[model samples]
Target: MPPLLRLVQQQGVIMSERKEGQSIEEIYADAVHWHVNTGGETIHAKRMGGRFRSLKWWTGSLWLLFFLSPYARWEGHQAILFDIPHRQFHFFSLTIWPQDIWMLSLVLILLAMTLFGVTAVAGRVWCGYFCFQTVWTDWFTWLEDKIEGNPIQRRKLDAAPWDARKIRLKLFKHSLWLLIAILTGVTFAGYFTDIYRLWVDYLTLQAPLVAWVVLAAFIFGTYVFAGFMREQVCFWLCPYARIQGVMVDKDTILPTYDAKRGEPRGKSRGGDEARGDCVDCKLCVAVCPTGVDIREGMQEGCITCGMCIDACDSVMEKVGRPKGLIRYMSEKEMLGERLPPLYRRPRVIVYSAIFLLSVSGILYGLTHIPPVELSVVHERQPLFMQMSDGSIQNKYTFKAVNKTPEDLRLRLSVSGVPGLQLLAADGDTVTLKSGKTIPFHVFLRARRTQLKQANTPVRFRLQGIDKPEISLEYESVFIGPSKA
Candidate 1:
């Protein structure tokens, strides 16, 4: 049987067995009273010390590179730079020009494929750990925690009347939040320009107008979204949240509540005699960043950060019950079905295939990038000039682009017809400016008697004098008098 079909069958069996113990009316009654989190009230989630919480902190810290990358130096230049004016992307030893923009497309494709593949296997790991919104929100809340104390204290402060102490605390927290926001803005702007120079410019009040506008926008965005808006940004602003439904399947693992084990709902006393594992403490909701009650079933608000699982496990430990009352599990697994291996899943297989294909294409494009690009345009007006010496002369304009950083002297030569000579303003050598296309007129003269056909194919070769390895070739037609 197909994996999906088998999973459906197993789910049917589990549902039937669970329902046999209780009537449909009873199940409906239980579900109707379940805790559902809407964005109506302020959720003051309790902070806890746990394994997943620590993992979240470590993973979220990776964003620090964004603030520091602009300061990195390589070969007396920014280590990684996107020089938009010059149409070049410099990465240490490698310099990519507009001619290599196809690689950028491949890179984007690879990233998208990776995200899709991971989403198919595990739901929203990117949003939970690596998303800028989540990371910044974490930082902002951590600062809030430091200034205002725990969740209860924060709630109290929020409800408290405007006193001198409240004013002072609020002012201090807002000031710090604004400072971090401004720093984030400045750091983002630094990526486009020199970080050290930008700091100097800001200090001297000599920065460009665009820089100031970008800084202000970033500061406002970060402060409002990370500090004030918080999970509301994820709930309403993020497009990924809307599209994630299509990427996930039944087998996708997510932080979930084991309803079967935790239902028939009774509170745990000092001993385990009277009820299911869940003590109805609501600690999961207390610790949720989005204030979602995992036991209520999956909802749009859950970031899958596993904070609820951590909170619930701590509660379970305290109440002398086994952990994982809430845990990471697939819908299929919860329904008592065997999950197919990751490679066997259709979505994973398809996404991985596309990911590999995109990677291969990018590698091929990079490896085969030509050092220099050349083109020759045959002058349309008077294609051939009959010289006094009975030679059929052709006027050709040579355009050679020196893509490298240094100016180069190139030697041009034409081949195909016998008894052909090149007449230029100079010898075979011509000077080309670095990163510029140089257009020059060249005369290709051949004895009419030596011409075999009216339009004979010829090839032009341009070789750099400084580096023989840097060369390009173009094929053109060598014109002659029509056969009578």
Candidate 2:
């Protein structure tokens, strides 16, 4: 049978012949009219109240932390700052330096695994609920709805001539959008510098050129991407949409139309028992933010937001039919196959393992961060010198980095060889400047007769004079002449 005839049969109504010399091609074309939005015109999605809509709003509110977190203070400084110029990251009482940047790799891995795992299981819930693009577009549209009115009125206003009322609404909406864009830019820039001073500089127009450039870029991106592009970004720009097919499988549950129950769609009339449950109301298409026709099947534009599910359920209730004409259902369920447990899925298992390992590594690195770093470089040129007193001397350079918040007076000593002595000074001490690496020279002498080998393992110890509990050690090789 032809595709249109098969579709009709699936709807429980099969027509043996076309109407009045109509060809199969014409019949199929008329029956299946799948429309895709290509950004030629604007889409004014109708807003509806439902459980998923409420959930979307709740999740989007989490972005408020982005605007408000920079102002939070901890110990006379911003609570969380990247401090890129100083090569430090501060979070509350803890600080991370360049030497500990490996933790950042683990953090990135954790985030990637989380995204993959969620996509494999739920199918783009992040894009629907928590993505910055989705949240900002929702916000912009909400404001548009409040200022202009419903979708019908907004469309009319756009089509209306340049009248005073239309101009006022457009100007007001754009001004509010620009304000949000500016705030977004400033808040982002505040993460790398002192937010209060940054705000003052921006207000006075005295900020550095780099700061101005960053602000301008962010403002332009936010205003254009969130306000004008809307769902077009998800359709044409997002790489995630292109790769989602590989991430999801038959077991993945998504907002799906029940063809078995909703086929042969027609309006229920007086004593018409042959019609299916769907009333051909098209409520699902009206409420979709992306203008996806769920009845046509899952499309690239579907974000799995579940808005159509809510709309379909509402229509089903109003028409005295069962709910869930559209719902989150996997292909296996549609085909009467049982879905395996999440742990049994290969991708989920791998993703969960990587996610756990990355979290563990990050925690271990953060908790085990050292308070000081030390390295010793033995002098290569003239590694050993014969002193006039018939003693052998060796030169070494010590580089110590103080990671503490305060300077320290450190007493230094050497061990590992008998009859060794400090040629520079006995019981000597050096000062370590806070948050800096300073290099200094140390000389050690040993009696010639005490030399047992050409190379000897030596340990250098640094003890804090004021805080005796602070001790650090570095092991180095002391070079000398061959035993004779």
| Candidate with the greatest lDDT versus the true structure | 2
Per-residue lDDT of 173 in model 2: 98
Instruction: Kindly give the number of clashing pairs for every candidate.
Output: 0, 0
Tens digit of lDDT per residue, candidate 2, span 1-484?
5533444433322233347886666666665566679898788889898989999999999999999999999988899999988788888878898898999999999998999999888888989899999899999999999999999999999989999999999999999999999999999999999999999999999999989999999999889989999899998999988888788877888887887777667767446775567788888998898999877666778898888998999998898888998998876776678988999999999999999999999999988887777888988889899889888889988888787778988899889889788654435697888778889889988887777899989898889999998898899877778877
Please, what is the TM-score per model? 0.90, 0.90
lDDT for each candidate structure: 0.82, 0.85
After the best TM-score superposition of candidate 2, give how far the Cα of residue 321 lies from its true spot, in angstroms. Answer: 2.3
Q: Please report how far candidate 1 places residue 427 from its true position, in Å.
A: 3.6
lDDT of 1 by residue, 1-484 (tens): 4332333233332243355577544544544443434456666678888888998999998988888888899988898787777777887757787878989998999999999998888899899888999899888888888899999899999999999999999999999999989999999888778889999998899999988999999999999999888888898889999899789988999988776666544565545454456678888888888877666567778889999888988988887778998888998788779888998999999999999999999889877867676778999899899999889999999877677668888898889999789989987998888778768899999999889899999998888788998778899998989988
Regions of candidate 2 where Cα sits further than 4 Å from its true position: 1-32, 422-427
